[model samples]
Target: MSPVTYADIEAASQRLAGVANRTPVITSRTVNELTKAQVFFKCENFQRTGSFKFRGAYNALAQLSDRQKQQGVLTYSSGNHAQAIALSGKLLGIATTIVMPQDAPAVKLAATRGYGAQVILYDRATTTREKLAQQLASDRQLTIIPPYDHPQIIAGQGTAAKELLEEVPQLDLLLVCCGGGGLLSGCAIATKSQPNQTNSPSHHPRVIGVEPEQADDAKRSFYTKKLQTIHNPDTIADGARTPSLGKYTFPLVLHYVDDMLTVSEAAILRTMFFLWERLKIVVEPTGALAASALLEGLITIPDTKIGIIISGGNVDLQQISQLLK
Candidate 1:
């Protein structure tokens, strides 16, 4: 498989221009004091459709051939990507079908349907979303737009990091929440490919991926130097509970990412609340994974300029109340 390159990311950025939200890079003095680092958060939580997935989904849909676009698109995702594809398809006047886990967050499910896509709910414990999506695509003649697997998707996701680096050119480290290595790999490619505007050759940031302890496939893959899988990890970070990394994303992660780290579920919940309480931002558990690792002192490096990608803000309010209770 051909690797996604900086040029691809640049093209994606151009495609996403004026469409995808260039989300803000947020900072808090309290968070900086706690981590002892100058923390800059690329807040994708505020992105269009309230997640970074819109960038990739819109870019992928925008690139489809006119015939394929007329035929429509199909994909499988837990939540954010589902809503992304649905909204993007709606914007492009194309039809979309999404295979989602039945147990996905209620808010996400509702938002996806609200975006006008046909929703197919499956048993995550018993059925594979990938196989189901493929079969449906074959039957319906719909183009398969995978959540994190395609080069177009990866390139589109890289735009978040590209935008961030363009804003904060002197970051020493960048931490990204990893789910099948899509966002992390994309960010790594974008950061490593571009020259920092700071004029310091050594100022290139070290990119690290953060995942849930229960869903640690990416971390295991990084350490073992091979692909790894975890079957239906029981974690609250539903977005990170992917079975494994994708073929295309795994290689980019291995080649460009510096390291992978895991944070405990407790830390994830704590950080979610912290972001809500302190940052005045509503970050979903999966989105908070990277920030959790940093807030909990999981990353050893300190007193450095760091960038953390807060992946999304979609959360079920009722579920949040239950979890808090």
Candidate 2:
């Protein structure tokens, strides 16, 4: 499939209309003082199902034909996407099955099951979720909806940027928390589509993808000029622990994304607390990644408006104390 375009995002907006929440754009006076730049946060943390994942999940599932939808759907996720798809499928009257790591956050696993999806847990270190998901799809003849890798999913995700840019037209840079590259890629396509907006001092937005230092597949892929996969990821940002870049998303990232960077786990935790104490947003480590990149100096833009995608809010309760401490 061709990389998602503005037209695709526009169509997705229609499909997702009244279904997806047009989440608020929040500005933090405290964060502005610290970053020394005006920051507009697109609060996907309050999105349906508590993350931006629902945008793509609903859009993708809505596009499936009646027969395919009846066959059900399967996907592999560490957490957010599992819940997103499960909930979306439930809303659409489709059966959903998710293969997740046994170590996935308890809250996420429970939420996925609560959405009526069959949750299959496997060893994160030993078993591959993709392999298991594929087997399940084959045995059950279910349609597979890959997290962050398909055109429909990417197009759906682009709607966030489309809405953000339309609302905050003066943004100079967009910092998106990267996991499997779907959201970032979608934002890139949306941002770059407006030729008058990119590179212009007033409206152009430099798109940057932020990943955890330990799980930097997009960073590696950007440097290698090929789709690179990380073997063993150990990061508090479980949403960003995808082992490899998807074929569909890799090319779009290579072409549209301006740069990719990594933020330390320490920085992520610090930013997570900062958001909670300051903005009063309960963001997960993965959701805090873009802010972490800015605070850690991994990404910088002087005297400009910056938009951050606060990706998700599904924090595991057990990690809450340590993350804040």
Candidate number achieving the greatest TM-score relative to the actual structure: 1
The parts of candidate 1 lying over 4 Å away from their true place are 197-202
lDDT of 2 by residue, 1-325 (tens): 4667889988999999898999999998877877788999998998988899999999999999999999999999988999999999999999999998888999999899999999989997788888888999999999999999999999999989888988988788999989889999998898888544656433557899999999988899998898888875899999899887888888999988988999888889888988999889899999999888887776656678999999999989797775556
lDDT for each candidate structure: 0.92, 0.89
What is the Å distance of residue 259 in model 1 from its true position?
0.6
- Where does candidate 1 have its weakest 10-residue lDDT segment? 195-204
| Model 2: residue 69 alpha-carbon error in angstroms | 0.9
> Per-residue lDDT of 1-325 in model 1, one digit per residue for the tens?
4579989999999999998988999999998888788999999999999999999999899999999999999999999999999999999999999999998999999999999999999998799888999899999999999999899999999999999999988788999999888898999999887865444545578999999999999999999988999999889998898889999999899988999999998999999999999999999999999999899988857678999999999988888798888
> What TM-scores do the predictions have?
0.97, 0.95
Clashing pairs in 1: none
Best by lDDT: 1
| Distance from true location, Cα of 57 in model 1, Å | 0.5
In angstroms, how far off is 266's CA in candidate 2? Answer: 0.5
